[model samples]
Target: MNGSLRTILAASIAAMAMTGVARAADVPIVPYVEPVPVGGWYLRGYIGMSNQQLGKLDNVLFTPGTVEFLDSGGFDAAPIYGIGVGYEFNEWFRADLTGEYRGKASFTALDRYDFNGDNIWDGSNDYSANKYEWLLMANAYVDLGTWWGITPYVGGGIGASRNTISNFQDINTPNGGVAYAPSASKWNFAWALHAGAGWEVTQNVTVDLGYRYVDLGDGETGDIVGYNGLNTVNNPMIFDSLTSHDVHLGVRYAFQ
Candidate 1:
């Protein structure tokens, strides 16, 4: 009686253990991972071209005792490039602090003048120089909603620039004269308005192509002198309302 009872109890316990092991193996085990969201710091680099203009030039008439003058003056196109670090505050907002090197431009003015209102001698002079600037700006932008992987944007910047004038020369053919203005540099208040679209090529990279209208204030030269019979000692030559129309192409690398 004792052996039969003990054997039956042991067999029942073994059967229950095997059943529990089978049930445990059949249950699935998978790890749960949360998805990450987007928004982070970025680095940007840009290269562009500027079509520049000199609004007005003065001090050309100082030597002729009220030398009345007529002139055509302008600045040539040049290249500009910059690097920046920025933050994407969200899908709709961003900002950057950038420093740029604006390439040199050729400046020329064809001056037609009469000394003392004399019709006897009508003469002309050409003034030339190379101008360049270094700019630092803080810019903020709004990225409109993306359409077809491209986002339209609008923005503005406020900054300062060091405008430099170099290689200043004056040539007068009629009077067989030559003159020079001292090359100089000036600090000016600068601002810009930007507009364009950005194409999101991948999750962490974007390409931006856009336009900017920048007002670089004014630029000037030191003093001047004329050779031969032409007028020499004059006030500093002024280039007022200096502005540029710029087109930019840039790339951004974003970090998460």
Candidate 2:
């Protein structure tokens, strides 16, 4: 009886070991996966085109009833370049500080004056100038989401602009005396609204295409002086509420 019992016990242990091995073989092996990365520092560079605009020119000589604008003042489209360093706080938020040099844009306008408020025009002034700016801003953005390797975003910025006016001329039409204003610079409050999409090119690189609308408060020139050494009081030429619509193509590289 002792020998029979020992054989049955040994057989049962072997059968249990075999069953455990078969169960292990029936289970599938899981492959390892990489986790998505988030939060990193980035460097950016961009080039863009600016379509600029200006509000009406203001001068004491041309009071409300005394000036009739034949052609309102405006600026020609110009090129823009910028660079910035930014931080991605997460997958859906980021901020940056940027500095940019706005290329010189030419300005032109024409206006007729009725000095005595008589609707009859006495003469017209053909205005011309070149304008440029140094813009610095602190910007923040919200990334809506990502799909097909592309991310869309909306952003805003608040900052300052140093606007410079150069080569300003008022050509008094019809044999009238010409006036000139020296180059001058002014600091203005600036703000912007941005919308864009960024395409991922690599694990650490992206290409951004964007549109922006910016307001550069105002710009002005030095006191106007006549060509023949005549200067008048309160003669500065004011460019009210300068603004621009900009399109940008940029690249960003992340440091991981």
Highest lDDT model number: 2
Cα misplacement distance, residue 135 of candidate 1 (Å): 1.0
TM-score of each: 0.80, 0.95
Q: Which residue runs of candidate 2 sit more than 4 Å off their true CA positions? A: 1-6
lDDT tens digits, residue span 31-143, model 1: 89876555789999999999998887777554554344465688889999999999999889999999999999998888766564656546777889999999999999999
RMSD of 1: 6.5
| Candidate 1's TM-score | 0.80
| Displacement of the residue 41 alpha carbon in candidate 1, Å | 1.2
Looking at candidate 2, the ten consecutive residues that score lowest on lDDT are 59-68
In order, candidate lDDTs are: 0.87, 0.93
Error of 2 at 212 (Å): 0.6
Clashing pairs in 1: 226-232
